[model samples]
Structures are given as C-alpha cells and as structure tokens.
Target chain A: MNSTAVTGHEAATHESEPGFYGTSWQKLMMWWFIIGDAILFGSFLAAYGFSRISAVNWPDRTQMFSLNFITVMTFTLITSSATMATAVAASRRGDRKAAFNFTMATAVGGLAFLGMQAYEWYHLIHNGARMDTNPWGAPAFGAYFFAITGFHGSHVASGVLILLITAWNAKRGKSGPEGVELTGLYWHFVDLVWVFVFGCFYLI
Target chain B: MSDTHAAHVEASYRSYWIAWAILLVLTLVMISISTKAFLIGGILLKSVIIGAWFMHLKHERAILIWSVVAGILFAGFLFLVIHFDAGTSLL
Candidate 1:
C-alpha cells in the first residue's frame, strides 16, 4: 500500500490519503516505532527474567510495592486510555471541544500516574531497596526495577507532553489527524507496554 | 475499491471501541492479579490485543510488519551472542 496516499482530515481527497486500516499515516508510523520499542524493552525484561531464574532469591512485589497507591495510579492510567480513545472518536466526528477535553483528561491521567510513581520510588528508596542495595538479595531484581520502570516513566512523561501539545493545537483549530493520531498511537503503546511492565515487575 | 474501503473503515470504528473497552478491563484485571506468574502472561496477551485493535497493527502494511519482525530477530541474535560469550569473552 502506498503510504503517501494517507493524509490528515484536510487532505484534498480521501483516496489520495496515506492512511492504512482507517488511521492516518502518522499513526501507522507510530505503531512501527512501538514495535521496535517493544523489542528493545522486551530484551531487557527477558534478561531480567533469565537473571531472576538463575538467582537464588527474589523479593516479593507484594511486599515491595505499595499496592493501594499503585492500584489508584493504574486506574488513572486506564481511565486516561479511555479518554484518549474518546478523544480520537470525537475528533473523527468533528467535535473539537470534546476531543480536547478528553485529551486533557488523558494528560491529567498521565500526570497522576507519574506522581504516584514518584511517591512509590521515594518510599522504596527510603526503605533501602535500590540498584546498589540488593535488599531482596537479587541484584538483577534491583537492576530491572530501576531500568524498566524508569524507562517507562520517562515515556509516560513524554507522552503527557505530547498530549498537552495535541490538546492545545486541537483547541486552536489547527490540530491534524497526524498529530492527534500519532499521540494516540504513542499513548496506546505506553499503555500496552505498561501491561507487560506491571505484570513482570509489580504483579509477577 | 472506494466503496468497499469506506465500508471497512466504518466497520473498524465499531471494532475499535469494543476492543478498547476490552483492553481497559483486561488491563485492570491483570494488574489486580499482581504478583501472580500469570500477570506476565496476561500483560503479553493484553499487549497483543491492544496492538491489534488500538494500534491497528493487524491493519498495518507488510513493510511495517516485516521491518519490526526483522529488527526483533536481529536484536535477539545480538542478545544470544552476548550471553553465550559473556563467560569467556573479555569486555
């Protein structure tokens, strides 16, 4: 398929648009990027798993993680994903205000998640479990803790920034499917990656 | 091509919302089961669902699919090579 045929809403003709699977070209590119990212992060988690298998002892996530706060944070993020999808739908219907509200809600969800993550880290570090401490007696555990979660957190921050920009542009009536869809793609990827991260780190 | 394409896009929007809701619920369930070995499986499975539905990977072009598969395979090769040689090779 010719990607050049895909275009944002304002393109001259829908047939000339480069979108695939009903999405804009930029959204497709973002998915391609996510696939590559999955590989990068997947390798890290695989290494962690291998190391954990080889190690004698591992810490309990139930003991290590504050589940109550994390649950709330997770709820916020899940809600954000819902809001983002709503925004996408609204944008398609030409409801700019609703779309902007949902995007802003998604951003707020991202920020709330980050704030909770910060609090979790503060408590965890204060309790002496760190990459150096190895309080759980598995150095790989500590390494994975800092590496995966830290990297995911950085992505969340950047995704929030992108959402903010998208919201602003949408409000100004200058937003294109390229930007909104790309942000949606990234936001969805972030949520997808978190599923694995949460499973490997917090849950499993 | 035009008429069929429009129909397909319309169908996709319906599926998209359904998929999104399924994903959201599944994610929460996976997280709720935190600390279970199944959590990892749940996440992996849920990711595929979201990728296919929300990210529309299932609808992506062949080039996109091949490139990602090739890249992951190459990275896996690198990992295997490094791990196999880590014992005897000097850093």
Candidate 2:
C-alpha cells in the first residue's frame, strides 16, 4: 500500500475527517442546523401570510403594533449580531478578553430584547389577545402573532443563555474560537428571522 | 501574527461595522417607507448583509453558499404556493 493510503486501523484511529464544505465540522454542522431552523421560521411566517391573506377582517397591523418600539427591538437584535461577529472575530485573533466582553454584551442585548418583547406581549394580552379570540378584527391575528413571535422570543431566550455560557467558557479557555463562531452563527440567524418577521408581520 | 494578518483582521472588523451601519440605515429606511415593495426589498437587503458579513457566508465555499440559498428559495416557493392557494380560494 502507498504510504498516504489509510489502513483500516489508521482510519479507525482518526478522530476527524476533512470537512466536506471546506470549513470545520463544527461550523458545517452549525450551518445545517441554522438551515433547518430557517425552514421552521419560514414555515411559520408562510402560514401567517396565508392566514392574513385569507382573513376578510384582518386587523390593521399599524394600529395594533407600535412601529417605533419594533424599530428599537430591531436595533437591539442587529446590534447584538454585530457584537457577536466581533466576538467571533476576536476569538479568531486570540483576544479572549475581547471575545468574552463582546459575548457578554450580546447576552445583554438579547436580554433587553426579551424584556421588551415581554412588555409587548403583556400589553397585548392585557388588551385582550388570546389564542382562540382577540380584540382584533380577526381571531387568527392573535394566534399567529403569539405563535410566531413567541417562538422567536423563545429562540432569543435560548441564545442569551448560550451566550452567557459561551462567555463563561471563553473566559476560562474551555471553549475555543469555533464555539464562539458557532454561537455567533446562531445569534445572527435569530436576527435574520426577525428581519423577516418585522417585515412580513409588522410592516407589510 | 504577521502584520499582513493583523491588517486582514482589522479589515474584517471594519467590514462588520460597515455591514452594521448599512443594516441600520436600511432598517430606518424601511420604517420610513410604507410601501410594501420597498419594505420587502429592504428586508431582503438586510438579510443579505447579515448573512454575508455577520455569518461569514460570503467567505464560505460556493457549495456551502448555494446550500443556504437553496433552502431560502425553497421557503419562498412554499410561500408562493400557499399565497396563491389562499388568494384563489377566497375569490
């Protein structure tokens, strides 16, 4: 056999093979996960679109939702995504301190977003929004609003927890640059989903 | 690290901030414009910026990039079909 040829024993001993996508396995797996999550969000938003189109008395989104508040939420998420990118970059450059700090900042941004979303939900529920019915023109409006935004909010909550853990591990040198990069990928994906949600549900 | 590498890192950092600025500007423009077409376009642009810069999809291989793009296109196809069906059913 050629020297470069892998024997069964050598292949068995190998821990990792080369990534098929020219990236690390961790990153490739993260991308696949993000794609799957994207489809989930896409399906939710598509259903929302169908409901809105079919409803005869769809509530006026402009009246129901505060655009200014949504803008702030958008700003928070986008800023957090920027911080996450910085954290990934810092980790790549071996600046663990910067990575930890930026990851913490991202977590803070996510918390702030969740807090604001909670307030929005509180206000809506107080104003008579429920799963089966709502003060809005169409009952499906409340259901879709709750389902889509609540699912996205849950993701933000999860991202915040992951960021906190990532920051802690990064500070102690437990997780490496790939971990931060993967977390950043998930965080950006959350922000991407919001971009579509904000447009389809709020603006359009 | 070499000076060239440091320069590249700095450039990458600069690109991230540039993308952030563009995203903010696009978002503000979207809020200002009430037109649906413009809003959809702005959202798409923002998604592109985030995917390319923050997620580093732009630096990835074409195969990886196409995989993502294909997923999004599939979602779009699904939406189109649902939208059409919903519209026709109501008519």
Best by TM-score: 2
Model 1 TM-score is 0.78
DockQ of each: 0.27, 0.74
> In model 2, which regions exceed 4 Å deviation?
A1-18, B1-5, B88-91
* Reference-based TM-score of each model: 0.78, 0.91
- Predicted candidate 1 versus true structure: per-residue lDDT over A38-68, tens digit per residue: 7888788667765655566777777788766
lDDT, candidate 2, A1-204, per-residue tens = 311111112222342544768776556777888888898888988888888888899988877788899899999999999999998889878898999999999999999999999999998898888987887799898888999999999999988988988888778776677777878888999999999998988888
TM-score of 2: 0.91
The pairs that clash in candidate 2 are none
Could you say which candidate leads in lDDT? 2
Q: What C-alpha lDDT, on a 0 to 100 scale, does residue A118 get in candidate 1?
A: 92
Given candidate 1, what's the lDDT at residue B57?
68
Model 1: TM-score, first chain: 0.88
Model 1: residues >4 Å from true position, as ranges?
A: A1-25, B1-21, B28-37, B61-91
